[model samples]
Target chain A: MSELTGLTLKAALEGLAAKRFSSEEITTAHLAAIDASSALNAYVVGTPEKALEMARASDARRASGQAGPLDGAPLGIKDLFCTEGVESTAGSMILRGFKPAYESTVTSQLWRDGAVMLGKLNMDEFAMGSSNETSAWGPVVNPWRQQGRNADLTPGGSSGGSAAAVAAELCLAATATDTGGSIRQPAAFTGTVGIKPTYGRCSRWGIVAFASSLDQAGPMARSVEDTAILLRSMAGHDPKDSTSIDAEVPDFASFCGRSVKGLRVGIPREYRVDGMPAEIDALWEQGIAWLKDAGCEIVDVTLPHTKYALPAYYIIAPAEASSNLARYDGMRYGLRVEGDNLTDTYEKSRAQGFGAEVKRRILIGTYVLSAGYYDAYYLKALKVRRRIADNFDQAWQTCDALLTPTAPSAAFALGDKSDDPLAMYLNDIFTVTVNLAGLPGMSVPAGLDAQGLPLGLQLIGRNLDEGTLFSLGSALEKAADFRARPAKWW
Target chain B: MAIDAATVRKVAKLARIAEPESRIEPLANELNGIISWIEQLNEVDTDGVEPMTTSVAMGLPMRDDVVTDGGDPAKVLGNAPRAEKSFFVVPKVVE
Candidate 1:
């Protein structure tokens, strides 16, 4: 029935409702695809039995005329989300065996909407690094390869698995988290559409914490409309998360294909960083042209504090991460190493449990938050963050939304930038500012690079304004018509 | 400022992460590059700027200050690495 696994979330829902296919049929198809595509290393765990059982129950409910919004849809869950009775590792050895008795608010909502859990996707440990290379479970290979090269490229991370799985057709769509481009960067690298909604749009109750202030859950899929539908179910005001905005969850999918006529789209001059690849700069122009063709007035805006965003993000994220990760002391759950005494055991377990990158961040976080350096590093970075957010507030005065390249470049070899942490951090240069500003940002695969790998254009919207971004993204999606799929090699 | 091996050891200790003497210098070198790069934030003149306290312009939403959860110890200690009668077992702190 039209290649069951190839259908988008929107198409799948239509198919399910029309009774062209049962939920069990689609769920089984996704399970088979995931079982065969292990080379991507996308999923940390696969729940075939659970998925089929849910699909059967979904079918029964649909037959009774009580279908939920996402009924019968098989989707991947990020390992960071605590699924009741399922192992939630957040891609670290420290939490290798930890399973939560409770479920994350986001996942619970997905299940309530009748979405099937195919499995838990992999991610960067504690969502620290830009690339998924920092994952203790090993790196997730990008499904898209360079034109003729056999070198393994990374699916941009900390939501690497989610992006790879979506691109490779392992599932309909996957849940993702963005703290400094975890969702967008990976989506850009994999030719998928992902949105990092405004901070506090989604409840952060049961997801593993990375940066408390910046972390937000969002959806990633092959199409903007799919992300829109998934985000509607994922986002809501949860009394569980204090920072969650107490606002009504709007019908996000209805915003897709909305007119962008007379909408002023901003192109920040500061985003034209020196030495950016010519193709990416060209792509930014192409996106602007497409939006202009869609009747959007293009305006050049300035964000003076743009360059300081990554630097400030590096400081603030790690500082919060160090605090969040301190709970993994080998006592409550996960791995434990014996030592001479309690403190020694704590130290030994942490040292052995954490990877090299995780340790580096923790040490940096500890140092910045330490007694002497707090004012110099952490406090100053916070001031810089305020300036960065102010930059967005000023831009919004002149434009409805801003457009830029999602990532600096297309996917690179897995080991290309992993060795140099700075090089890896630079991958999020285009994405970090949105998180710092607490704005909604989206990545839509607009075109391919010279190497035949897909590149994406990012849309930055004002806070609580993801609907406009969705409309703009759909316009770009229609104009560019980026329907290219990575060749099936895995 | 370049992070020294001594500072690395000190930070590691404060972080409660054990670092071997041999790994300290390498870790320091690795951290120094990142710290130096991040020090660029100092270039922005924020003399009177307030530190960003929250991402969104919203106050923390408060619920009724009653205990909403707990009372199930099995669920609480369900994933613990070592638990005894609902208590987490750890290395003895007292001699």
Candidate 2:
């Protein structure tokens, strides 16, 4: 039972296919693990009954030889994706107890593939903050503690809960979204593998909106192969999402372990920001060495506008968020805090329902998009976004993919950077560039930092070129052989 | 271009998020800190660059303007915080 929950998604699927273990057994094991994982605050809601029901249906499918690609696999859904009968919170108090009448397209596809929903994982409220502290349910504790210390660390955000759950084996794998570094940064922090596929790779119809142009759904798992497998099942062209790329979903898992000989892996010189830990820089150097050893040629590339990505992201994301979030006006769904008038009701509800960080972003977004400041902040940021994308376009002429350290440093203790918002925004420094460029970016656990916490290496790929990232990431994964797990204290 | 507490108050109102008297100043300070930091974008000369509205290569696909879905008002009102007769109940706006 203990070992059953430890199987990766690929292994679990094969195990189910071979009838080595029924999904009900695996689901039961994971449900028990989730019950014991409350200390980590990984999941905001548990659907044990629903999980069992889905597992039994999966088992019946397998028995009938009608299994799908991900048949009989149990996975955790991020709170942001609405599940038909399950409450999807998006990690905000305002969305409490609001169950969707329909399932998100991505999740509906997962169910179509016979994936089981263990529960909704926590996240930064409305996917805003870099640290999970902004979650209305309270901050999710990083499953990894610094060696021989009792202090808690953040698993990074806004996919913090998904990373922690995957790291702690609370689920086989999880579905996560990225707007600006949400998936990759959290995956880097927790030593899991996560990929934010190319902008149009997956349908965004039902995942709660953050920054529409930047938001994408992807997979987080324990291994490069597992992440690839999950991404294959998670991605496809959807008519519902107008921006969704009308393309075939590649068999991503097959790309893992493929040769990368003569592949140009670019190392962006602009990523070497000041004050980054030496170990992180060293890990990046080691990553380059590993790729070179894997029959790949390393090339230096420059994303000149890289430094502007974070600021640009903060502006554009909040601007879109302000407009996207305007729908929550004490009306159709979720929490409602009444005031004397209709407008007052909206103000009071949003003020009371939203957490501090969310309110902060809303105000920033509002102010930027306001009458006078639109050109100064929002439009300026958009133009910077163009330059940033152009920089990537220039880099692609020289290299097939780019490599850098996933986060500036390993997971920091919660509350360390939360007080200072600018300090907190800096956490996405290494990962934000990928989002701004609307490209696929992935984080693979490559090594551990000095304190023995896991560190990750990021891989950036061109538009619709996630298969190459999977291949390169697998090479890094194989070279590093990062198999360390956080000590099971929870 | 740093904003003051009064600006924050007005912005919050614009955002339809009420800011309490005590919290307004702190929110202002936080917003100013972020805004000032963001002012660095000015250093990048984007004189001729067009704002990137999207990264997807294609324009949004056009579909017939037909009602492909909806009509189950009960389903629409299912998640409403307050509902009556398939209508979402809210504070009265009209006199």
Candidate 3:
């Protein structure tokens, strides 16, 4: 691995500003690293020429004293974002060969700050699955494997490629979207840092829609500071997306290293779900202790609606997804299958285009939103969602933030739970409520599990209070002091 | 409610996705499993609770009725599977 590829995003920025090496050199080094790490399947497309061109421009800008915050830094984009002139498949055959004519607002912002694109990363088909197995491109193998084991484990999805790429040092950081733990769960699995900012914190204009209400783009990196740095560039109000929050973007990096003293951190007792691993419990205790040591007031709180979040999330997400995906008929872009008639063409194209999981979600979505079942399923789930958010609202009155295990367990083998959709859905048990409540949540690598894979603790903050999460996250990052990297096997 | 094969076919048609007879049973079973799991929501009392349509509780921001962008037909049709001149070509509907 090249030394340049190993540097954190902040370190790379400093190096570029110091002129220790040109952006071209670092970008080239990362491109080579990406080439050597193809077995990981982290990136779906590798844009070496485009990366070098952007890097060269960044270097020239630096020489002219016009460098941006992320000038010359290379990052991976989750294929969910529509990159102009680059095929954005959302890891499904339905969108095969479809490239957007315009760039997503988030990626365009990164480019404006002089960030170089390494190419699109893979994800679950339309961000629908808990594991990357749903991806038509293939599953992303986690860089970390169990000690003395030969079997490859899954980097959690649907941002598995982004997490794997950052964990493997293929990019300084990667852009990811979290609709029901796609970002935070994958980050926890790979020992990287990922944040799902409050809903509407980032624009969803050019990203492929899954569950529009739950989907929010965020950053994934090796450290919380780097994640914060990347997020500052990625977030802002955009008129294009009406849901985009009309708020001032904060200097998130500055929130790091701030004192956590006297802040109240809530521990929700309802998260003590059945069958939680012993190591996860111990890690949560350790995290609470660390916060206590940092002078935080640890309060035990209750979110009674926690148990209903997963089921409600499943109904609401897929219901919205079914409606959002109605645009992918035979006439427009993407894979089209012709038939005897227009309606036949529509049916045939969709049946042939979407993968099994995508088809399943669409089916479940359709069923829930069907004529007779609408009130029983979709409407009931929405009411449950409201209660879940109300639970968070009540908890906020007592605590400044909340902490929990990011996932129930550490990374498992690729095929471990893919056969059971319910089993896969349970993986988001600890992380989904944050999305339901539209709060900012982050995963910080806290410790390793019994099998030596990394475990993360989640920190969730109030709406538009990412700065507080960053502060607490940095403090936890310091206390955990997790510097372990996966042994190179790929 | 358990989703029957007939209902599965009906919903698949509603969703505009073709489902052959061979796959209908398995699809019904899978959908039934998921639907049953989510049916647990009925256990909660929500008589007076309003269904939350969005995470953020705000009205849709309205703008003046005017064209702000989008005039290039070529760009709009750039990714169309089948296009002629400036329009997407679909299977014959009005013929």
Give TM-scores of the second chain, every candidate. Answer: 0.88, 0.92, 0.90
Task: Give the top-scoring candidate (DockQ).
Answer: 2
User: Of 1 and 2, which scores higher on DockQ?
Assistant: 2
Error of 1 at B37 (Å): 1.2
Worst 10 residues of 2 chain A by lDDT: A429-438
**Residue A307, model 1: Cα distance from true site in angstroms:** 0.6
| Candidate order by decreasing DockQ | 2, 1, 3
Enumerate residue pairs that collide in model 1.
none
| TM-score against native, each model | 0.99, 0.99, 0.99
Model 2: per-residue lDDT, tens digit, A1-490?
A: 2899899898999999999999999999999999999899999999999999999999999999999999989899999999998899899999998889989999999999999999999999999988899999998999999989999999999999999999999999999999989999999999999999999898999899988999999999999999999898889989899999999888998999999999999999999999999999999999999999999999999889899999999999999999999988869997899889999999989988899888888889999999999999999999999999999999999999999999988999998998888888898898888888889999999999879999999999999999999999999999999999999998
DockQ of each: 0.88, 0.90, 0.87
Runs of candidate 2 exceeding 4 Å displacement: none
Position A487, candidate 3: lDDT = 88
Q: What overall lDDT goes with each candidate model?
A: 0.92, 0.92, 0.94
- Kindly provide the TM-score obtained by chain B of candidate 2 when compared with the true chain B: 0.92
- Residue A256, model 2: lDDT of 96
